[model samples]
Target: MPPGHVADRLAALVAERESQIVLGLDPDPARLWPDAGGDPDPAVAVLAHCRAVIDAVAPAVVAVKPQVACFERLGAPGWAALAATVEHARAQGLFVLADGKRGDIDVTATAYAHGFFDAGGLNADALTVNPYMGLDTLRSFAAVARPAGGGLFALVRTSNPGAADLMDEPLARGGTVWERVAELVAELGDEHRGPESGLADVGAVLGATQPEHLARARELLPHAIFLLPGVGAQGGRVEDLAPAFAPGRAAGLVTASRSIVRAHEQSGGAPAAAARAEAERLRETAWALG
Candidate 1:
């Protein structure tokens, strides 16, 4: 890997932390930590909840995936909160993957990239992008991310049931839409492959809910890191995701939102303590796969 490539940085962090969990921060204003609700402003409450969650789980995870919509709904205050959340995660030594799933063409794509990768913006370590518009859209994101030592995780086969509507469609050319998308991800990622880690700056969002597709996805994206979501609350098991770690421990990042944050609801304990325990459990399980 290049000295300062994003993939190299990610791999280094994974080894240092001895974990591959990516804490998903999809904060719902109506459902924050009990103490956070004391704040009148929803955005402030959300930020407090995020900080508490990070503080609890930072030691067990290598990164945080912040769902942008969760913060965007509150307008300016929410955006400010999102920025603060990213900064706080960084302060805790966790990578920030801004989950906007943004897609566009030309200058618009460049603008979105800037919002996530440039100075004074979120300055995320990576961003989730929608590749439905085609590879050019990804190119725009890479154009910005590469220079900033950032990365991009393109939505290949998402965890949502609705994804089957488009992603699973049999192409007339004799492959599935997602299979074709995987090919594109491989094609683009090859250009920026990390030498030491054998990972690419460009990666794939392969939902962990569908383990059957993982072997096939890995076949197509050998060098791309897989952001495997859907564990715990979404019913994805860590054992089924072993294929994603074939390249190395950092090759797959298991992201869990409600599974860790709302653990108190199921385990019945203090929110932070429950969340910390859940995150540690997930970290241990995923680390074993490597």
Candidate 2:
């Protein structure tokens, strides 16, 4: 399917679900599938763990954001597993957000666009991209994304502590660099607005870890959806992300991966069962907030 078609479907899913929770699939090798046995192929174990987690949480969330690095580290097998995960998510009626954070010159950016958005490739409904190269770079990728109906979540304010170094720097024209990124998110998103949801195709990733930024980000991109990461294991509070939904409760998407997947450790139960319980818990909490 084309990318724009995917975005439309995702918008409908978000509205129908009345919940914008996008569970992240950032699998940490050591922590995930520890019981898969130290075989020659750890990637297989990771794939199994990822698929199990997806099955456990698919009913509670609208989308899944897979951190590409986790797969990349495992080489070819990892990429294969990543592809399988994407297919699995789609089969379950969930959108897949390829969280690669790729950005570069126009030519390379276009390739990255193809790598994620192309029909024959991974076939993701949306992908997270880095916009540091400039508006033109994003514009290049957006050209491909807009037509396909795929969405891109530009990184604005990340959850990591080191983000303050660059994102917090004051700019001559206005607020911080992160604020400028928000402005770009709005401007670039002008073309992809969904008529029903009043949300633009271009979105922003505002870490749930930094709830305060939500207020500012919302002001900048009122019509854009905010992909809120850093929740659960990252210490992002659900209550703090309320501003992301000022336009509507569906405006903010709460994402969690490790917190739910590793929940078995605390529950002292089967991994799949514990994971499902954690996902349901997060779903209930996020819905209540919505």
Candidate 3:
């Protein structure tokens, strides 16, 4: 039999695990494991660090989100590292969400869609996509990912302080642009809803920092998964995100990057131990809200 659809598959995983925590692997060259030390090739150091993080945090997380920019900056080798990271995450039986935020139109977008396909080295359960250009630009991405049991997370309201400058600007049509984008995402997701899951494959990239908007966003995209970023290091409290689970606990994926991986610096313990502890704390806290 064929694999289950991506939307239903993700929902099942979340339900089975009883956890919605997504681990963010954003390895900085400056903060790599002490032994990753002194390497001229940043990719080498990054790869070593990522594998270790995956090993350390696997048990506590339901998924792994590898930052594409961090690896892409290292050029070809960085690409190699990202591919390896995705493979390792899958091997550990965790879902992989490629946090690349890719956006384009026509042929260019098609090429990008191919990159995230399961047949490629960068195969991921889902990919973070940008819908700034237009909702139409996202068509190709959704087209490719959906059929392959993969999905896309289109940015709606981002976590960065600067996001308001563009995403929050009011449009003549009414409300902020992000609100309009949310509507589009809802439609896209609905079009591809899983018959068994009652969820959509086109998820949204929402920020945990703006939890207040969660209710409204939910009103618009009831079926799409909301990838809530900015928790922990970004000062987004998990308590404020209950609305994201309005659809169900499995509907929201709370993401944390520097917070878990670098917890040892502030909490004081072995890096791996601190990271695991922090991840468990987050998982427990989030699971309680619903």
Indicate the residue-level lDDT of 281 in model 3: 91
Question: Higher-TM-score candidate among 1 and 3?
Answer: 1
The TM-scores of all predictions, comma-separated, are: 0.98, 0.94, 0.96
Q: Summarize candidate 1's per-residue lDDT along 32-109 as a digit string, tens digits.
A: 999765698999999999999999999999999999999999999999999999989989988889999999996899
Best by lDDT: 1
Better of 2 and 3 by lDDT: 3
Candidate 1, residue 102: Cα displacement in angstroms equals 0.3
Q: Name the 10 consecutive residues with the lowest summed lDDT in model 1.
A: 1-10
**Which pairs of residues have clashing backbones in candidate 3?**
none
Q: Tens digits of per-residue lDDT for model 3 on 1-290?
A: 02778878888888777789999988888888665535777888899888888898888889999999999888999899999888888888888899989999867887898887758558788899999888778998887787788889999999999999998899998999999999989888888888877889899989999888899999999998999999998899999999999878889999998999989889997888888999999999999987
Q: After best superposition, candidate 3 residue 167: deviation in angstroms? A: 1.6
Residue 127 in model 1: shift from native, Å?
0.3
Q: Candidate 2, residues 1-290: lDDT per residue as tens digits?
A: 53344445666787776657787887767777555424557787778778878887778788888999999999999999899989888888887899999888899888889888888888787888898878988988888777777888999999899999999999998799999988988998976677767778888988888887787788889888888889888899787777887877667788888887788888878877787788877777877776
TM-score of predicted structure 2: 0.94
lDDT of 1: 0.93
Question: What local lDDT does model 3 show for residue 88?
Answer: 88
RMSD per model, one decimal? 1.5, 1.8, 1.6
